[model samples]
Target chain A: MSWEKVFFALLIFPGLLYAVPTAWLMLWLERKFRARMQGRIGPPFYQPFFDFVKLMAKRRVLRPSFDSIFMMGLPLVSVSAGLLALALLPISSDSRGFAGDLVLLVAFLEVPSLCSVLAGFASRSIFGQVGATREAILSITYNLPFLTAIVALAYSAQSLRLVDIAASPAGGVRALAVLTICLCLPVKLRINPFSVSNAEQEIYSGPATEFSGPQLAMWELAHGLEWVALTGLVVCLGLTFRTGTWIGDFAIYTSLSLVLVILLTILATGTARLKIQQAARFYWRWGMGLSLVALILGVFPDIERFIR
Target chain B: MNIFSVLLKNLRMGPATLRFPEEVPYPKGFHGPVKIHTEKCICCGMCAYVCVSGAVRVAEHKDNCEWVYSPGLCTFCGKCVSVCPVEALHMAAKSAPSYFNTKALDEVHLVPYSPCPECGRPTPPVREVLRAKAFKGVAPNVLVKSLICQRCRQKDSQRALVSIQVKGEPPPSRSDK
Candidate 1:
């Protein structure tokens, strides 16, 4: 068998099963961590699974004149898009698609966000309307800073391919790229401040409000896979790896996943939610602007060289 | 002001719901319903008399042979216990009392009177002093006692009919005790 075929098959298996427990696990962990930080005991690890089952058993009732097919298709798209993103990302240097262009990776990342907006629009709920608006605004906000960081890295490396970027010299503005990526972490995870799409206080889970039964479960599963995919992208793009064996791949991916989960939980517990406008303003005014200046400074490495 | 304070506020106020299936300690100053012991009650109306809250009421039903305490009106005050001639009305220390509505709040009962076997009348005491006894901390108009006039008590001993005791203290227990 060809190496690419083996890698592709390997990726498919993990991505497909990723949603099964990942959804329940992330939800339970988030609740548990938040509870402990607040001096209480939260629900058990199985709580999310039980909740999914309960919601599934409820009678499937749609609103009058609602598009059932559109609503149903959106969640399926979310799950598949997230899984596809996971499969496309390079797990290690040896993995297939590591040679893929940075722009292709960006395109893959956009799919899940697109799915989120589509789900909101498809539901035809007022909350979904609000969610879709906020989500679109969020896309406009973070996608800039996020894309800028990737572009800065790509520019410095002199290649659009992710594997080539990893192969580049580490002496340039690599550290700056890493910092910006870390700051963008919350947005990519759909956490606080930028989490207006799922604002429970304002719109009662927004796009997810009307979605019950298996559809809700699928959406939640897609969310978890997105978390995993984002973390994998971060690890693949920047971190140096020593992967000679399958065990090494497993250990690295697992540790990275845990770190991302912990980072998100802490951020969620510690931060207050931001208004839609505040989120837009922060990303546009300060976050994206700071990174842009960093990118510009990084590219023209020295007027200082001439001055000195 | 800073991220730390904001986080602290969110953490403290956020939904960190408690685990159920295990008993939780009652919050401070939680007042549960008052308890009354029928055997120890001296029927002294002191609980009703001293009760400034008007939570206690006592009345007489003539046909029954016992005094009925409407614990619904009884406050958790030890005052009723303190004033009882025979220490009959004692408040139990169990404090958890959960209910669906406000009506559940004032409806506990203790009956000292029993219905007559022959006429179903709540038998009344022979002496005026004994008949005047009321559960402590109960309301004035809701106690179970004699409803027929003194003349009716004297004239009709055999054919006397029992009426529902609707006066004095209201029962504190909403459900059957």
Candidate 2:
């Protein structure tokens, strides 16, 4: 890709401009939906943006032992990883299709959580330490099923390229694979019930406790961008419907994401936060179980074809 | 009960939060600030006495009777309103608005005292004294006697006791003590 194309993809098209705002909007939607469910008036549409601005305006404070450079840089690294993942995803059937992009996307998806772990360790706070440990354990618990679900999708499409996956018609096994992904997304996103890593009530924002000012703002931004990337991935891999025009395709993609977001919000509001042990057990049992079934279903192409 | 069902029910019912500031309707009987009707207030000091937070101050002097309320210190318990003898105080359903400066929150209402009929000295507000008399079930004659200043009233009481002693009647036992 040319430098201009790289810049456009990374900073404009599917990167900072597109991903950041969309993620902020999605976070706002989650808050509003949850508040409504609890019979309360939630914050306005601009609340997320306001919070970001407020965080940016705050004074930066660093601990004596912490490396300021590493602490500040990790959030950017996470955001870049998410943007790269989005760029790798072919938005339409005619878009570029790279080999083994699915594997690359999965690896990129893990970077944000890994960054959180590193950040937590770097902070040297007790809450940060505990939060990092929880995140590490959660990453382990959810990554297997998440990756397995993706592999199941790949097996169904017979290609690791995202474009092929989007182009193919979704069937029973693929639908189950999508369901497995849907279940795991909440855990990955740290939404309610599966929000053991952050566990705000217990740990006071967990891994993000010590980060302040621009660093904290970037972390929040990275989280939002990650939301876009991961949800966009789900939409691309599971709910993509091509139209001849880019606008139509983009609209469908956004609409599907809205549906997924609504579903996730409802689930979040309905359930209480789970303990770390409970979360692990839940993933090991239900998460792993569903993905295993999807995997079994995907392995038998004849069966999937017959079902279709 | 499934959470999904609860969520669905809540969605159907809509939000429970009021659109405050734009539509400032509070629930019925909601305890807010203590509202004083200065005209009805007899300065009986019941509200001041009952106030737990020391937000109410009823100062009755020779020259003036003042009822001061500090909204900043008010607990909004409605105890003062409940204890008011003449129903001068009631809990308004609107809270005190926040102020940038602290001094704005303190409110003072001063009612000048009425002169004593005989001694021509400053006394408690006439309306307040009358209300207190009525609330305490004092007879008209006793109410008249209570209008005198402390020194004159004491002298009058002493003269009455001497007259009673001369009449060979035992003075009424000091029940107030």
Candidate 3:
């Protein structure tokens, strides 16, 4: 790929410039939607933006000399990784991503989470350490379904390129692949039911308990970008319409991502937080079963023909 | 109904909470900070006596009675208002504003003491409301006796007895001589 094209992909549409504002908007919408459901007036529309700015202006927390640099680097790394992951998405139809780019996307998607697990331990706070450990355990449980779903989609397309898999026709296997992946998003995003690690009532802010000021702001930005990058994946695979124009496809993608956000908000608002053991059981039993079925069908696409 | 139905109903019904923090209205029968009506207060110290939290304090000076009430110390139990003799203490409709200094939040009222006309001694002022309940338009002489100090009033009664004992004679009391 040309350096100019690579820079445009990483810095322009579907990248940092587009994702930052959209991610913050999505976060605010989630909070507002939940508040309304609970019969509250919620916050003003500018609340998220104001909060981000205020946090950025606050003084940084004093940390031990040995840990200050290590603590500050994690959020920066996560945010960079989150932005990199978003750039890999083929929101535009003329995506020139290379072969096995799906593996790159998945690898980039895991970076923020791995950094979070490290952050919790590096903070030297009891809450942070406990939150980090829970995050570590939950990640292991959720990745089973996440990886299998991607593998099934790749197998069905007979190619490892995300663009090819996204272009595949809709069918039972593709639908199941989407379902399995959807089940993992809540856990990955740390929303209700699977939000045991970061439960405010239980472990404070999970791995981010000790981070403050600019560090905390970066962590928040990374989380918002995660919302965009992950949900954008769902939007890519789920949407099939095309008007043979860039702007038209972009509009469709944006609207679908919004709809998915609303659906996720409803799911979060209606469900209560789950205990760690309960969350693990739900994933290990139900999630493991669905992922196995998708894997079986993926490894043997001819089995669908035989069963029919 | 499920959460969706409830959510829709709530959305249609509008928010159950106030839009602004200051917009929340005090509930009915909610007792707030104590407010004293300086005009009606007799400074009988009944409020201070009944206050369980020691929120109400009465300080008696030679010329005036100082009534101090701190909302911070007040339990908002309304006992002090109920025990007030002249209906002087009543609670405000809303709680006091944020507290920075405790002394600044105290509601202070200085009720002037009425001096006895005969001996220039300070006496607890009986307001019209208390006077109406204590005496029902008694004779002028009786009213005059109540208006003076006890020492001066007792001397007048003693002089009347001596004069009654000796007809056309001056009283034997040293002051009369």
Best by lDDT: 3
Q: What TM value does the first chain of each candidate achieve?
A: 0.87, 0.94, 0.97
Order of quality (TM-score):
3, 2, 1
| Top candidate, metric DockQ | 2
**lDDT of candidate 1 over A1-308, digit per residue (tens):** 37665455335434666445665676677777777666566788999888877766777666554577866777788777776666665555565444544776678778777877877887888998888878888888888888788888887777777767766666446666766677777776778856788888888887777788878877777777777777767776666554868678767876776677776787887778988778878877776876786577568767424544
Docking category of candidate 2: medium
Tens digits of per-residue lDDT for model 3 on B25-61? Answer: 7788778898888878877899899989899999988
DockQ of 1: 0.22
TM-score of 2: 0.83
Best-matching candidate per TM-score: 3
Between which residue pairs do clashes occur in model 2?
B42-B128
Lowest summed lDDT across 10 adjacent residues in model 1 chain B is found at B157-166
TM-score of model 1 relative to the true fold? 0.71
- Using DockQ as the yardstick, the better of models 1 and 2 is 2
lDDT of each residue in B62-150, candidate 2, tens digit only: 68788999888889998998877667788878777888875688888886766777788876644654546453665556567666766
Candidate 3 Cα outliers beyond 4 Å, as residue runs: B49-55, B61-63, B115-122, B128-144, B150-177
